[model samples]
Target: MRRSAEPDPSGEQAPHWWQRAVFYQVYVRSFADSDGDGVGDLEGIRSRLGYLELLGVDALWLTPFFRSPMADHGYDVADPRAVDPLFGDLAAFDRLVTDAHAHGIKVTIDVVPNHTSDQHAWFQEALAAAPGSRERARYLFRDGDQPPNNWVSVFGGPAWTRVPDGQWYLHLFTPQQPDLNWDNSEVRADLVETLRFWLDRGVDGFRIDVAHGMAKPAGLPDMPEYLRSVTGAQAHGVDDPRFDNDEVHEVHRLIRKVADEYPDTMAVGEIWVQTDTQFAKYVRQDELHLGFNFALVDADFDADAVRRAIDLSLEAVSRSAAPPTWTLSNHDVVRHVTRYGGSELGARRARAMALVQLALPGVVYLYNGEELGLPNVELPDWALQDPLWERSGHTDRGRDGARVPLPWEGTEPPFAFSEGTNTWLPIPPEWAGLTVERQLEDPDSMLSLYRQALELRKTHAGFSGTDIEWYGAPPGCFAYRRKGGGLICALNTSGAPVPLPPGEILLSSGPIPTTDLPPETAVWLI
Candidate 1:
């Protein structure tokens, strides 16, 4: 391994830092709790910047912490400019931003663009104004309350909610997150202003939420019934006229214009478009800098599936000459550990996949607690908080299972996540052995493996290129060499073991119990 090819994080010369950065996603309420308020806050994140610095991430993305009613847990922003009291006030956020920069970590916060909190001032005013008034025009308020068209909420209900005035407003998500009418110039202007507000406050960039659905088709129309059950802000969000329309490109272009005002600042979209071509549109030359391709996150832990994920992900980004972004899990989906199989085998695969992701030549995103190899917690019904839990009549388990608080240092429940027992979501009792403190002492632990891989990814010459050349391999196994960089990444997704390619080993997720790589294991070589 060599020293980083890039300049120091504090250096101002690396104008294209985003092209080579590795981002860690910080799920605010679950990352850490400095206030003992049973929730993770910006101050807690500031306190843990050293841990992240040592763990080797270039930057971090904090899920929304702005002023909000917490309807969608901060995604429903009441005021994008103000820090929410729940995550500490503006002063605390400022301190976190200052500290993070000092630690050489860039701060990218979530910006929800497609909708506004129903409790937002604009929405409140819209509710009181006459049907055709400017206030109402800020939103998609329609006449004839028979539930405007047949659109369904992504959270599983009617997208239209009638107000006292007898007109219905559209909300692609839960009614609490009312969809804004982007057709209105005021709506577009406010969003650009919002971007500048945070940029001027010294933040690095933004992770645009629902980045693909901001523009709806003109003349609201009916959608297929099947879309209702799958409609969401997650991976399945791209069907129908309500999402990924060509007009959305204009919205992104305007956003990119605002972001370009801040040097080195970039935007990554939560684009859920179904095809590589459609996904590429969001990352065109004048739009978002990156778009999350969830192929890796949605794939099963098998050789063919994993290969396809990598290929498709890269193809999509290549369409716009944009760099690929990789991740196996995030806030909206089941953790890969649990999704892989929920046992020792599952944990093994998760660790292996982490290397597969880091070995790629693009931005890599690790969700909070992912470094600790945390699995999803199956919460009791009474403890669930995701709106989808109730919105689907309790038939859908929702995302609470994956949002459990991170277990940091302790051996018990709050596990150093908080001083109190009221964490937003309960940590499983069995996670005692997987705490960061414990993993720090075990070289074979998942945490250590991640640190080593990241450290190598940052300094090794083998990780510099974006192109990959595949090598013929046994069934249930895959091997690929990085172009222009003499590095190889191999995986054993089968029940049996496979021999590693001939090269000096750079890293492996765990011990190679034999001459062959174990099942669910991945290795890096040069």
Candidate 2:
């Protein structure tokens, strides 16, 4: 069994601010472009603080804006403390943080501790030094005729890349991102410094990228035969040698130590462990403050699948008494709208899921454009930029579709996301109907639904609880109520309409044609 963190001198542990807050994920480059450079930047985010406040999110989790070569779109960090010129400078980030605070929104940024860009000074020095030099100690390098092991890259290909010195280094994602050796004291200390650098700048928290990574298994071993071929969503299930090792807990503890130094700072990890016991380990009292449970993100639109995901997620976090985190879509995967079935039906189902998600008792992370009910775009081959595209020899179209720039206020390509006609990823012309400007004017648009739900979540007494109670419903529907509050949430995925539980209707995902709930619809009641 696990216990909560030690209580304060007052003898009661006050809930952290993030416990009940909704975090909006801003994939920096695709969010907004202030300079018409065809890419979004920190200044662009600072310009949009008002919109986020209006949308009612309590915090903003900005993806990597750290100095990087952009091989992995900022995941391959070259300098963890410096702001990438592509985004802005240190002064710009400080302004964004200060302004966001003025709007009552906490700001959290991504930290990629598992690896650094190959262009980093350390990697450059390692390349020039002898195989056994001190510079080589910072990363995972071993002399080998073959790759150090049979492990496969998450982006598709051998995980090891050989150098002219006849030594191979491990890069689990792309060659540009070399995995750091957590066993190296210097590497661990540098990560601590990185955390303090941003915390000292007043960041409210961090979204730790690949929190389950960093600690590699002993002897640089090959993965078991059965797990080698697993990739993508299924990869989390098998015990791949690449991630989720037992030693990873020590790395998280180091992060937590630094986070505790700053008042009200938090650490939420991007964990993908599937088993309840394994997942719970990352959020234990001494480890990450919270860990993302991706079961719901992987769930389909079916009622049973959604219910199972919810139940499993709750169980996983209950062990540590940590608040569970939920998200339907992110920059890495296919958007939930497209995953639910794509088109009008997909939008309807996505809206229903939002009600289901927001009604639950924990933190919610809404990916940008999700509130607009955005679906994945089918970009031409030339438009694909995800490393997976080239790494997979183009067989996998990659995540570029889900990362298309948001449609803000225009009727054509770029959709005013950039001043020029081009965006990093093109916004489809058909999205004119889904622009934020258009949605704001419509009383019944997806944006409207989210705004109303967020307002209610912030003010309604019915949302005041930490647990939920399941209710009996029809064959393809499920209902649950906040354990302490009287709020009730019901969803119907059946072929026909079903009777609603007796209560006042607070909101519905779609228009109710009668006194009953329609298929692919959800409702909140009190």
Residue 410 CA displacement from its true place in model 1, Å: 1.9
Candidate 1 Cα lDDT to native: 0.87
Name model 2 segments beyond 4 Å from true: 1-13
Report how far residue 369 has shifted in candidate 2, in Å: 0.3
Lowest-scoring 10 consecutive residues by lDDT in candidate 2?
230-239
In terms of TM-score, the best-performing candidate is 2
Error of 2 at 441 (Å): 0.3
- List candidate 1 stretches off by more than 4 Å: 1-15, 235-239
Q: Cα lDDT of all candidates, in order?
A: 0.87, 0.90
Expressed as tens digits, the lDDT of each residue in 1-526 for candidate 1 is 1112445578665437788789999999999998898999999999899999989999999999988989889999999899888889888988998999999899999999899999899998988788899999998888893887988887887889888878988898898998888889999989988988888888888999988787888788788777767734562544587788888899889989988777678999998878888888888899999888889987998899999989998888776757999888899999999999988878988988998999988898899888988888889999999998888888888998889998888779989899888888878889999999999999889999989998999888998777999999889999999997989999988888788888988898878866788888899999
Residue 525 in candidate 2 has what lDDT?
93
